[model samples]
Target: MDVEADVIVIGSGPAGLTAALHAHESGARNVLLLEREEELGGILKQCIHNGFGLEQFKKDYTGPEYAERLIEELEKTNVQCFLNTMVVSLSPDRTITAVSPEKGVFHIKSRSVVLAMGCRERPRSSINIPGTRPAGVYTAGVAQRFVNIDGYLPGKEVVILGSGDIGLIMARRLTLEGARVKGVYEIMDYPGGLKRNIVQCLNDFDIPLYLSHTVTEIQGKERVEGVVVSKVDQKMNSISGSEQSIPCDTLLLSVGLIPENELSKEAGVELTPITKGPVTTETMETRVPGIFSCGNVSTVFDLVDYVAETGMIAAGNAARFAAGDWKKGRNPVEIIPGENVRMLFPQRYSFKDDLILFVRSAKPIEKPVNIELSPLGMRLKRLYARPNEMIRFKVSRDKLKAVTGPIEVSITER
Candidate 1:
């Protein structure tokens, strides 16, 4: 069967939910939201924690509560939502191919589309840790689902690798669930998660956090028995005499996240090597016009509030595009990451409106730092910055008058 909508949103995560709601509110009738999962919340349904909604709603809410709130608001709108629907392919011309057990196979032709499929955790195979095929090895996200959703304890003794937010959160979660957490080990010299997580999840719980350490070997035949931990030098080469044995039944990995962009590739959207996400303009529209990207699909965002914010940006512009109120063919300016800046999004600027930039630092830097934007001479100061936390700043359209060419963003230390 064939369907049509003014706006089509893929994925029912925070970004997609917000995009669909805002698109309908922005005057796009027939907004269609498709979700692959049986539920509407995406990963949030399994995230039973409470550190959400502070930024967007000014209230601290558990993951399910936040999702329920959004779902409630969406029910009030005219957005048409379909759960258990998997979008198999997306076309540059706004054609979507999806399959569902109920609908069999269907196609959707939309005036505009939003990509908000989010991201996935890096598994043990991605890190290539030398280990036997064991049953106790799982990504932090999988462990979270097992405990929070499936009502099963993963293991009694857990050894967490990587200090990413999920790993850190799981370290505490597993500990609270009667699991003896040996420690959280990180290959990096610094923590991978936010300072708040490090403090609340590790420091407060009296759990040890070992920096510049890695698990060299997982020793187990059937289930996990133990792991060989080793200290690494600045270059991440394990030191010969720094090996230690730690007995643990389970190993959790939270090394990194990769944006889900297979559909983006099918649509021939240009992606950045740095972010592994689609190249977007200031309005969050991808290289393929009428198609937009947001949330973790744009980049592995640290906060859900920003994820929803990007959805609004994408939806507002998508509604305009669907209504033929958008102007095309403008000279796009490049936004470059300079010294001490690791990643920057919205690589292209239209210079038509104000812009918000998301930035990540190359390394952790102490107080008295300034985020400097060249050519336009815009600067924002911060007390401290780290690669784990993203920095957000805005540039007004009025400032574009001073920018003759590309903009270089960098972190300047005092």
Candidate 2:
């Protein structure tokens, strides 16, 4: 099959669905939405929690509900959709080759492409726990799918490694399902998930969160019998005498997430080493002009609202590109992170209008501080900040125009 669309969206997650909707609304009527799953909702289908859509919908909605709303909106439009399709590769000129059972080896030549392949969980192998390859080990997301989607209990006893949002949520989930979650361990003193998740999921459930702790070894051979955990110093080196064994049948890892960008890389988009995602401009356009990126594919965003906002931004710009109204000109100023700042998405900004810079700190700030974009003279007050929580600031064009060079963002204690 040979198909063509004004905009080709790679994933059917919240980001891709919104991108296709906005693209269609922006006069790019021939928008195509593709999903590898049999359904359209992506990971949200398995995420049955109720914290989602608080920002976007101004009310608490479950993950599936949030995705259902977007999917419903997409259905109201003339957008074409292909489910259970696997995109093989994307070319530099915006050509896509994908395969599906119904439509074998289909090709698409699109004017602009929005890549929203989302992210993947970092497994135990990435951290390389000193233990045998056990059958009971699972990623937090896998456990979520097992319980939420398949209605299968992973284990009666669970020990979670890493305080990632998924792990914290799973800790509560397993506990609710009558499983004894021994504890949640983290190498860093601070939690990796949002404050709300830590409070509602872990603290509320009476699950102990072990700070500066890590799993030193996996004790079981066939299935998980127990794990040896130890306290770590600032350098993350294990303390010899601090090791303790916690017996459990399952160990769910929630270490981190890696952006799915092999397709972006194959299409020749330049990615940042820190983000492991494409270095996109303010318009969410990659260094390769016609291809755009948004959502978890651009960076691991904390909120679905922000991801949808990026999708709209990319779609608007893509519509302009498809309409021949876009004139690619000056280079965008680099946005760099300085002291106490860990990462900032949309690493490169070129637009002169108002734009939002989403940032994460290197450490948790106990005292009040000001997030300053220096040389540009832009400052915003943040009462408190955490490495796990992303901070967003809207910068005016006047403030941005004051800088002739790259801008550095840092946190200054007040």
lDDT of 1: 0.92
lDDT of 2 by residue, 1-414 (tens): 399888999998888988988999999978998899999988889889988878878989888998999889888899999999999999999999999999999899999999989999998889989988888999999999999999999999899999999999999999999999999999998999988999999989899999999999998888999999999999999999999999999999999999999999999999997678999888899999889999999998888889888888888888888877787666688989888988898788786346678988889998899998888776789898888989987887666765668888999788
Per-candidate TM equals 0.98, 0.98
For model 2, the superposed segments whose C-alpha errors exceed 4 Å read none
The lDDT for every candidate, in the order shown, is 0.92, 0.90
Q: How does candidate 2 score on lDDT?
A: 0.90
Clashes of 1: 0
Query: In model 1, which regions exceed 4 Å deviation?
Result: none
**Model 1 poorest ten-residue lDDT run:** 395-404
